[model samples]
Target chain A: MARVLTIGEPMGLMVATEPKALKDVTTFRRYVCGAEVNFAVGMSRLGHETAYISRVGNDPFGQHILDFLAEQHISTDYVTLDDVNRTGMQLKAKTLEGDPEVVNFRRFTAFSYMEPSVVDTVQWESYDHLHVTGIPPALSETCRETSIAMMKAAKAHGVQVSFDTNLRPALWPSEDVMRKNINYLASLADIVLPGLGEGKILTGFETPEEIADFYLKQGAKAVIVKLGTKGAYVKTTDETFYAPAYIVENVVDTVGAGDGFAVGTISGRLEGLSWSEAVRRGAAIGALQVQVESDNEGLPTLEQLVAYQNSAKLSE
Target chain B: MARVLTIGEPMGLMVATEPKALKDVTTFRRYVCGAEVNFAVGMSRLGHETAYISRVGNDPFGQHILDFLAEQHISTDYVTLDDVNRTGMQLKAKTLEGDPEVVNFRRFTAFSYMEPSVVDTVQWESYDHLHVTGIPPALSETCRETSIAMMKAAKAHGVQVSFDTNLRPALWPSEDVMRKNINYLASLADIVLPGLGEGKILTGFETPEEIADFYLKQGAKAVIVKLGTKGAYVKTTDETFYAPAYIVENVVDTVGAGDGFAVGTISGRLEGLSWSEAVRRGAAIGALQVQVESDNEGLPTLEQLVAYQNSAKLSE
Candidate 1:
């Protein structure tokens, strides 16, 4: 089986314990860091051979993440421990009063201080596929350089690279800086996944087609733009396709849905699924994600995925 | 001054937000609820004549007792929104490993269903102390009867009542039950203040006692239990107090630190040096809150009370 590697900083996540506003609630739940790590855990649960790469603090939270990775069966051979800084964290308020609000407490955190010294020790040649995201580039200069170095090393070792533009405005200095940095990272990937809104911001394109075209021209072999309930748009060298969103009964949270879509598409590619089938899998997984609370907790096992796909077809 | 009134459920508050456990946060903050209607908003800041009394949703959380009234400017105009059902809410998580843990979801949601017929219309003749917690015996047959009857007749007689036990649970069998039962009818209060932690189940409490104990004894006058940086906790009786917690370098959040303790404490009590010299002003304000993330915000505002008492002693 081909081995898949995902790298990024995962910080702690705090979400509202109930539907009440933040000022109203007297409690909250806690979860460990990074968006990409969440997806890695999901893919590993689907029985894929997956490895995660990142740096974490030397504190209990870091140990907790490591223990969590081991429990999820994702490889942590490439993970590093930082002695000085502590882990990062984010708090999501339980408010429907406005746009889903998130308060980040990750400034100057250990994840943002990840250095090239940590990256230099990784064994890049062992993985068949590598997944990267835009967040690392915006964290710190050292992390940005590490992202570029990892991509270059992966290319040299003939590993396919997939990139997700998980834009977080609070982490960056300005929109222009974020766009420039993210676009630069996209140029190093073979596959690019960008959410509809994120794609618009990164490529300055209003429509998915325009966004996909922009990435494809930048050297991505294929580009997929995630459109929440409406599905996704895919573009390749010679053709493009549109996949409709899977209908879900409720959308409890939309936080990790995009990451779920990326997992489906990337894992499908590794398994040699058809382009259409891969995008279909992406939409299917994304649909499941919104119905649950955690970022990757609702990801389906391979058997579950097949059953869901089969049921969808039978219903049609 | 103007007389203010409020009505709603008051829940037991346990906060678990500090780096240490719940016991450690004890030195953190304190305040009470059910009585929170008077102390939290009505009695302290508004300086209006205020009264509060309600049977709490019965459970260990029901220990709210007379604590809500002793600390603020509230009087026991009508107290008793009690129920056999669980008192809603528990400690909110400060870390990211898990979401805020709840003891129960208020299985019967007994507080909101208070009956209007049982409230004695003649009860409003005593004076101008009108306050209420969101939870009342109203959740069940006897409780609801007491709340509706008391509130409607009070309003007709020009008595001002404030309602604030913001939201208990949403899965109360139906939405119509929630909207028609909870907000629309409860909004008749003269002043209303529901906060972040008060609205959802998670992402709220950081400290417990400091957040829940500012309200006073049920039979007494006035209350307020919000614990914002240890500032402010007012109640009627013959004494009032103010004590701020030791300053901290970082404030994770100041969510419910204001509302759960503001109502009656700042608005109701008699104003004089004697009124400001009591430790119950701090003890009632300093109870078991501040350990959680949301419910109770911080310690009682007792420094002013101590300073005033010391000055009175020197004069004597």
Candidate 2:
């Protein structure tokens, strides 16, 4: 197992229990989730030492988040409770098929109140890997500056950095700023992950090869590309390959597929697996994620991952 | 001091800290508020033994409401926390003038989970007055039935019932249904209070005299009509008159003015004041409410109320 660190907001998620429009739905089941939250859960399930850093409101939602992270076996040592701001929350509609409609309440939340000083207390040298996402930087200018500071300090301390292009267009002030800042953050990481659809928007590149090459040229050691259900495209300095996607007949929900893939790829590399094997692991987890309703709930443990891959290979 | 009792929801109100549209504003100051909640605060401040009965979610907002009511010296012994439903919430935009843009998240809230069983537990006979609102009935059918049940039981136990036609058209299913139900609630009350604007819509009567008579013929002992800054109109079997409004130079938020008026009239009557004096006191409090930011923050204690009324008279 490797020691992993990530910085992001964990929001209180309220999912509708019935397959009705959110306006019509009255009852909702509460859960804790976010992109980095999903990533931490995946890493923990695969037997890694993981710690999360963020701020939540001093409210019940904050208490719930702390309790949830503890239950997931992820360290909350770096997490803090903020008094002036509220914890973020999301309301998602239940859908039988396709992506569920979501309404987010994250603006000016506790996580958005985070500043560059938050990075000052972290013991960066102790971690083997640092995972960062685009969402934090999109929250506010302070967060963007803080995110860059974290990656730079992690590098200064010899910790490996991974950046996920988790685009949140609504959070950004403008698309031009989003593209420029996102690419700069990507340039700071050893590994960069971008879904194919967002890759086109972020890089203005039409093909996966061009997109991966764009990031590779920006100083990243490897660029992993998500290709929806088709699989993933991988490119590194030494070699490049394509990993086939694990296919499921019915897709339950596609909200957390990319985070699952990131978990597999990051965990694999930490265990010293070759790029092909790691990408293959990522593809398998991404497939598993789309078959569940809530984000990260479908993520497999190390044993479950191996068994699932073996069953798929046998059927093929 | 009268033993005054009321049943209603106490909501978590988020008032924007800046003068901006709600969608544009991010910083909010939290406060506990609601129409009935405002009325209870006024009654409690006026030396009455006020008791509030309602359901709230087992969340931070619910805890805040509980703490707030307790601090206001209102009894919360009958309030219960519900695990499944959430406390209602309102998001109000900051405005320099006119009514603020408001967004409500009150449908299917914990208060709506109330049933006729709640009325069974209340010692209605021990109370001198039962203050009810039309807003509760508009929340949902269950709340409507429960409101009626409380009134019926209160009447059976000889508790004086004062119903406020606080018209909330959006909460009801249809205009026709809202009219019928609100009028029915008025007929069950010993005294009926309705804003002149709402009175015109609910009774199809253009003049306050006609509107008051509409309810008097339905068996009400008295009818009081709010006439905005122009004052209030009052009618009883023996007397009919208008209490001129205590004018305020610059009005603040008008959200809780009616509740403040109800507080004054009810408290005045409980202290054995005449109908004319009670209406005059109600008008003064209603004017005072529109001069402050929060709903009940401008409400004065018994001493302050007397001082304000006396000062206004001396100046006149």
Candidate 3:
């Protein structure tokens, strides 16, 4: 039995080799990156037994993703193969200043058309935690049903659930439907992690406290509000805390910082850490993630995490 | 029967949507862009009767490429479908200041594995001009042999040949091998087009005149030296001419500018334009290409070219 299970579509990632604009670039590098896969990789690096369950195309890119997971020592037995469509992908270009430009290439991607019957083979009772995001549902109706089915099965088996509102506006038809469906999913999760901006848009809340409160009122056991570089705010039935951000000298890439934060929080909680301690670990890991490129390449192992924490205290 | 025939691998192109660093990009857009296809598209737009000969994977991308060629009204009857390897692709990143970054995904590509047997199906006697690049030879041994075989067949059938020294450093084992192979290819061409930098490195020549002289001595009837934004210098058996640069207002993308120049020069020659007129058209097209984003999107139509030339003369 794994400590954590994450299910979503993993896409082939294409990036500019240098910090040149898209029009001027003559070369690029390739990798596998997705929000769910990032979390799975991060959790596995942090000494958790993580299982990634999803469908990938039977293409070279799909093989590349499987090979990558094998190298990371993450379990993929639950992943199915799709023959009809090719794996999804994304292209990224970055400049010297400001946020990176992103474009989605997942329309009619293989995973979007994954049959619901494939999820029946997944062992529901073998995981302590189930982590999901809003992307799979918005991909296709079949994927939406699969997501809902997985959530229901996990709940029935008494597994803890974590849902991140990783909303992609381009994937959805309208804001109203997105909010309705995502909010419904939030009610099924034990813990809800949503960025301040995402929560504000989904729930029409202006402040972090209001955003957290909205989710908490929607049957969540706890709500963690991500505030970008300012760290996160946590609100539970009996307690609350504001975890301060760790300052890093340079911010190289910001793609998978949130997933890193999720890994830290999930791993810390599973290890029986205090709520504040878990949030602190999350902040530390998230800060470290921004200094490196790639989604999971910057993830720290459990030993490295402890060393970073100890070194910071010693220097203070 | 077409005036121009181009032989090379046409790869699918995946690009990042916005100006985001590789590590921070979360999405991408997909298109089909390659050196040969770029040249074919440009020439077709310039009113040249062009035929493209190559192999593509029997995949959606291949189908898409066929559809795109039809949309552009370029002939694709000579394109073969491969059952084994998939179509090659390149990932491009959006640029901010200079040239956009490019990453090649062409290993074991279907076009690289093109069998020499496929060339038997191509009608070599019908074409007036055949344009070849160094990339086909660098792909694989099979592709290299096919390139050699095609050149021999074209020459045996009395087809004029134009070769471009589009050097890809990473594709070759060493600089020595690249130079040796490229120079041998130059010997087979009636007219050779080499960038100033490429000519310097390949022939160890300091001046464009020296580089042109070297190729001319190597059996080339003429040589045109590309000087980037400075325009081009042409040396033929009859005369020598230097085309002045056309000043662009703002440079958007520069990926396919060289190919655009090739298209203009080839179309001009086929139309019986004088050496100076051909080089001038090349410079005008190259200048126009840098102001557009996609590699082949900004190629000027025959009407556009005439209007541009007429307007420029009026302004002067």
Candidate 2 local distance difference test against the native: 0.86
TM-score of each: 0.54, 0.57, 0.57
Candidate 1 docking classification: incorrect
TM-score of chain A of each: 0.93, 0.97, 0.95
lDDT of every predicted structure (CA atoms): 0.60, 0.86, 0.81
Best by lDDT: 2
Evaluated at residue A213, the lDDT of candidate 1 is 92
lDDT of 1 by residue, A1-316 (tens): 5688888887655566767544344455656547788789768967888998888876545666787788899988988787766565555655443235564445455677766665567676677988999888887898898888888888988999999998988678899999998999999999999999999899888999999999998999999988877888899887699887787766777777888888888888788988888888888888777776666777888888888777753111
For candidate 3, write residues A180-288 as lDDT tens digits.
Answer: 9999988889999999989999989899899989989988988999988788899988788787877766777888888888888877888898878988898878877
TM-score of chain B of each: 0.48, 0.98, 0.95
**Model 1 alpha-carbon drift over 4 Å, by segment:** A95-99, A313-316, B1-316
| Model 2 docking grade | incorrect
What DockQ do you compute for every candidate structure? 0.02, 0.03, 0.04
